[model samples]
Target: MKKIKGALALLAVLSLAGCGAGSPSSGTAESSPEGTSGSGAATALEKVEVGVIPIVDVAPIYLGVKEGIFEKEGLDVKLTLAQGGAAIVPAIMSEQMDFGFSNVTSMIVARSKSLPLKMVAPGGSSTGDTKADFASVMTKPDSGIKEIKDLVGKKVAVNTLNNISDSTISEAVKLAGGDYKKVHFVEMGFPDMTAQLAAGNVDAMAAVEPFVTISEADGNVPIFSNYAEPVDDLTVAVYFTSDDYIKKNPETAAKFARAMTESQKFADENPEKAKAVLPDYTSLEPEVIEKLTMPRYYTEVNEASIEKIAEISLDRGLIEKIPDLTALLPSK
Candidate 1:
């Protein structure tokens, strides 16, 4: 509880500084679930809605709906795009969304706050490739920042403070024999981070895919893969729902999980298909979309990675206790 309050206090200070966390304010593009409308079988399908962000991590779900995988499971999944997980969590809690896709760190924080959310599927993972992962610790050329350990005593830009950026980066630094507590974190949206990096406002920026690729195009060098180190093939994010919602609709949840697992398998096997459907839901240009780094779509979550994140969260004082994975994670 003390740690949660400290995080909220930090949020207040950051919000007053003009650079803060991204909230859900913009309208989302609505995509039709396969066989939900066109085939005159809409009535037979179980209408489902999920909150998502317009990023490379969500390609599997989009591809699943596109390839009729969800339809085959008797579920009609509608995706609603939000600015970030901050918005999606609320939507799920309020019954506006049936499920949501969010990073494990944020979900852990939510669970620590006693929010009755539960992970239902493995949503995103790192490729375990330092040079070509979905996200990286990006620094400008000749910045003297070459690795995660060097980031100690330097200012790092994260979309949100006290979240995964601090967790993963600190862990990598600790593994490299550096002091994790010496690192400084600042809050700014991803869209604004690259410019800040170029201007030398931040020493290093936790850059995610699309941004990592875009920043690299502008000559910024990657120090290391942010989601890869400390644990290779780390689970970066997850698909989840309100605990109450799951309890009331176990069958629906099971069907969604089965369909999503199939979706992950399909995306894992056909990486091009994942890229091909990006333009259908996002506003990114063809050229940029073509070069975006995609995350691993695994049907199973890396429990060790999740546990490591929980321990880091406890260390960061983001949570008073490590969350109970058995209760929060999907059944194996």
Candidate 2:
């Protein structure tokens, strides 16, 4: 009876082993029952490090993080603040982050450098109606600066060189018969633009979103919003991850995308819900957020729009050339 019981126990062990209930074959790593392989499980629980520039343009991702949507997608997300869109690509290349929010201009330049940055989501775009989303070259309400033509040889504040703000300002200047080269471009953070303009450090600034709204509140007025001009369709904001990260962990990336897309839908369908959640992730005051005009959230990246930005940059000498976008983007 003892011999028979021992034999039965051995059979049971063998059954479990064949069913992957026991340790993996010595030659192969074991996968958790929760997933297909050890790598698959690892991917699911992967810690996602996301980088963002603090601006209302990126509110959907903020809302996603604040709402725990990434958590719901089996990702542990960490956010790092970047100085501007231009800084985000280098952060991704150095592996300082797995994902980041950046503008199309920077993304194009990075792509031209073969940075391995893949744009996974669209962040925002310009509209014809307002400067509430993107930057507009502005002066004091009573500065008597009626048009972009007035900016020639005057100090202009921009968040960065060769970015959306500068590009928009250049276009606006051309339309107003001002030479962009004559306008002195000053690099300043959005928050500092108004103060600098007020303090007489800058004659005008191309400011975005809440900054534009805040400047208006402070009696600073825009000469022209980018939306009012005919310019290339540029991506105002986008989400990216390294190609290596995506290839190694497709499921994890997909999960992240699903969560972000859902959040975009939520923000689109429920503006008040977005207003309620903005303060949880952004520095914008609730009242300021309430007063701000937000952009429509879009989940999918538009390839044509991205290409247009690259084309514009190339035309405007922001980038020497456009990169092969195939590898840096998902299958359409």
The TM-scores, one per candidate, come to 0.88, 0.78
Clashing pairs in 1: none
**lDDT, candidate 2, at 241:** 85
Q: Give the per-residue lDDT of model 2 (tens digit) for 83-127.
A: 555555666777777787776676677778867778777776565
The TM-score between candidate 1 and the true structure equals 0.88
The whole-model lDDT of each prediction reads 0.79, 0.64
State residue 195's C-alpha deviation in candidate 2, in Å. Answer: 2.3
Candidate 1, residues 241-288, lDDT tens digits: the string is 989998899999999999999999999899999999877665556666
For model 2, the superposed segments whose C-alpha errors exceed 4 Å read 1-46, 131-134, 175-177
* lDDT, model 2, position 180: 70
lDDT of 1 at 260: 91
Worst 10 residues of 2 by lDDT: 15-24
Top candidate, metric lDDT: 1
